[model samples]
Target: MDSNDVRRQWEARSGEYSPEYYAYYGPNDTSDALRCIFEQFLEPNASVLELGCSSGRHLSHLSVHGFENLAGIEVNPDAFDVMAETYPDLAAEGEFYLDAIEDVVTDFDDGEFDAVYSVETLQHLHPDAEWVFDELARITSDLLVTVENEGDVDRDGSTEPDVNYVNDDFPLYYRDWNTIFTDRGLVEVDAREGQRDTIRTFRTAQ
Candidate 1:
């Protein structure tokens, strides 16, 4: 699928993911792990940004944990609407972008955010838009975390894109995230494989 098709797919699934389920039960296991990592490495005032943050469920978890300087980039506008309803404090306090990440991420100044993270998000980025990985590296000043579907991410796997359309209806491009960011000038700090995703944390070498 092309970038536009990927964006449209999320837009269509917006209400389905966050508005209903996440709204009721709130954050999940990954969300809790994300918060703990942030707490271990950052202060409450750190400028944090989440890419493809659907309905602020994860960001809301950060907000409740005392991390106030929050932001999100979401392609689905309805997700923002649900964010406003489900996580009102987050909706009011956090900055947000309602557009495809490839289009808006470049607008951020170099090292604009103290920490940047994504959960099951970057894996969906279409191959044509993979350049945004470098953009993400450019914008993050301190830490970057990627919680994505695990796949080939070894010595040879880092050399190229390892893509898989996990579902007929959506694109799930597994990538060697460690090599991708490390080559972009970040150093891997920690990596762990979860039940459903691989979580890797990177920090700017500089």
Candidate 2:
């Protein structure tokens, strides 16, 4: 399937994933790993850009912990509306766009954000991961936190993802975090493995 097809699938799935059961508790032990990274890498009251904020799960968590300047990018307008309405004090209304990743212009001036984050999103990127990493590098000034499922897959034949949120067509690379980010000038600061996921925290070189 093409990008448009994948997006439609995501939108169709979005309605079924409610914040109550799925967003906070459905993904297994990944939440523990993500919270650990959040506590370790994120600064108090820091400006944050969440690439795939999905129902404002992490944003809500961060806000309760005193990080107020939070922003997010979600392609599903209905989900974005729910998030915006849910967290009016923290979420910037209409900031979330229903556009594709490549089309949405981050447009932030240089060093405009303290950190950029994505969770379970990269594995589904279309046309490979080039555009995803490019945008991560473009927006982040200091830190980038990512969490993806690490599992072997049949890449050459069936384009089905090992993880639910991943896009099967792109062949998700589930290797060591150090190996993945080394060439991009991002140093892996910390890494941990959960029940079926790996969370990597990287910092840009000064």
Candidate 3:
């Protein structure tokens, strides 16, 4: 499916899914890991851009930390509405665009943000990573931190770990901490693994 199709699909499920479910019960350690990683990269009053920001949980966390000038791209209208209510001021700026990551319009000139962050999001864009990464790097002046799921789950509904309900079209790609930063020209700053997999934070110089 194309970006619009993906956005429509997520829009359908947006009401059914919330930050609480994605954080506590989702297959990823999004809440804890995301908060911890951002604490390191995000500075007070820094401009930030987030891709696939669901329910704006990360934005909420940063707001509490005194970080402003925040923006995000999410395709789910329901989730975007919730974010608008949660962050009325920023939302009014049209900073949060409801479109697929690939379809997000970048009004910011090059090197417009202090940091770019994504958590448990990019893996879903299996075939679209190059485009997403290019956009992220284009807008980010400093860093790009991402948290992706990594493990073995075969095609069948059964596996050694017995984890099923896999979306093979968006299969997870496992990479070491170095791969995200060094190998990909993203400076390897720091990385940590959670209950399931790796959370790698990388940066590129201005």
Which of the numbered candidates is closest to the native, going by highest TM-score?
A: 1
Question: Model 2, 4-122: lDDT tens per residue?
Answer: 66556555564334333344353344544555566677677567777766777776667666666777776666666566566665556324556556566356666567787777666
Which segments of candidate 1 are over 4 A away from where they belong? Answer: 14-19, 152-158
Arrange candidates, best TM-score first.
1, 2, 3
Ranking by lDDT: 1, 2, 3
Report the Cα RMSD per candidate.
1.9, 4.5, 5.6
In candidate 1 the C-alpha lDDT for residue 53 amounts to: 89
The Cα error of candidate 3 at residue 197, in Å, is 3.9
Clashes of each: 0, 1, 1
The per-residue C-alpha lDDT of model 3 at residue 174 equals 44
Candidate of highest lDDT: 1
* Candidate 2 Cα misplacement greater than 4 A, ranges: 15-35, 84-88, 92-95, 153-177
- Please give each candidate's TM-score: 0.92, 0.76, 0.73
Candidate 2, run of 10 with poorest lDDT: 161-170
lDDT value, candidate 2, whole model: 0.62
